[model samples]
Structure formats: C-alpha cells, structure tokens
Target: MAVTVLSVNAQQRGNRENMTPEKMAERMTEKMTEDLKLDEAQKQEVYDLNLESANKRTEMMAKEQTDKKAARENMKADQEAHEAKLKEILTNDQFVKWEEIQKEQREKMKDRRGGGGRPQ
Candidate 1:
C-alpha cells in the first residue's frame, strides 16, 4: 500500500514535468478509471489531488534542481575554500558510506523508472 502511494506520488511528479495540465488530468482520469477501477467522482477527486501534488512537487524539484546546478557550478570554488575542512570532517569510512547511500538511492530511482510495479 505504501509503495502504491509512493508510485502515485512519483507518477504525479513525472506527469507535471512531462505533460501539460490538461493532458495530466486526462491521463490521471484514465488511469484511475481503468487501472485503479475508480468511478467518475473518485477519478475526479484523485485527479485533483494528483494535480495539486504534482504542482507542489514540480516547484520544489525545480528549485532543488536550480540549487543543485548552482552548487555544481560553485563546486570548484567551494572545494578550494573548504577542502581542508571537508577532509578534517569526514573520514574515509564516512565517505564510503556516503557512496553506498547514493548507490541505494540510484537503485530506488531506477525501480521507479521501471513502472514501480511489484518486485519480480
């Protein structure tokens, strides 16, 4: 059930990024009606909810992406400023753990891309 909700949340985000509002609504309606077996009223409710969530996530992701891009651009400058501090702060083990966590996150994203269906 949790996975299904998360999948819906991700789908909402993808719809926001990939399609226009009208198309997103139409697609959501179709999915709710056909795939989820929802009725007209339920579909409308779901569509509205999804659309609202999508808008919020889209804004947040856009902000995050912008922030990330800026951060990347400043990496060299920041590294020059903070490399010594970073090395003092994080030991080799911590860096290794960070890499592992990033790998796990990438795997989860890959699963989401693959429809987020039941595990095979």
Candidate 2:
C-alpha cells in the first residue's frame, strides 16, 4: 500500500514536470470551460489566451530573474491584462464567479504553504 501511494505521488509529480505550455493551456482552458460554461467561440478564445499566457509564463520562469521587484511588477501587469481580456470574454456574472473561485484557490494555496498573511 505504501509503495502504491508513493508510485501515484511520483506519477503525479512527473506529469507536472513534463507539462508543456500547450498542455498547461489546454488543461486551464478545460477547467474554465467547465466552470464558466463557455461557448465554442469562447472556449477557443480562452484556449488561445491561455496558450499565450502559458508561453509567457514558461519564458519568464526559464529566464534567470535578477530583479525581484521588476519580476513581480511584470507578473502583475500580465495578470491584469489577462483578466481584462477575460472580462471581455466572460459575462459579468461569470467574471464575478471566477474571481470568487480564484480567491478560494489563493486561500487554499496559502493554507498549504502555512502562510499567515505573507507579504508579496
């Protein structure tokens, strides 16, 4: 049983390690589609947006960042632009729900990291 659990965990970790931008974008777009009930056109748009964002993120992570503040600002700008596009694509109600979902996920991540309001 212990060996089986370890294998499963290792498999999951390996999947994450092997994920490419295309695969990451597809997974993200699928989740958004399920959550927001996106139409075909919206799904395609979201997938494109996700692909672009994923590629950018992969590029950023690959580079050796020298300035932490600049990196943070860049990430913030990218996030804001992404949300702006999403707002244009999603309905107001869906946008609100998406924000709520994001908030919940952030909270979960904080908890996982043993965070007590760490500064960004």
Output candidate 1 Cα RMSD: 17.0
Location of the lowest summed lDDT over 10 successive residues in candidate 1: 81-90
Question: Which digits, one per residue and each the tens of the lDDT, describe model 1 over residues 7-83?
Answer: 99999877667876566657755754564455566566656655654454445545656566565555544434433
Clashing pairs in 2: none
Tell me the spans in candidate 2 whose CA falls farther than 4 Å from its real position: 1-14, 117-120
Off by over 4 Å in 1: 1-16, 65-120
TM-score of each: 0.38, 0.85
Q: List lDDT for all candidates, in order.
A: 0.57, 0.91
Top candidate on TM-score is 2
Clashes of 1: 0
Error of 2 at 96 (Å): 0.8
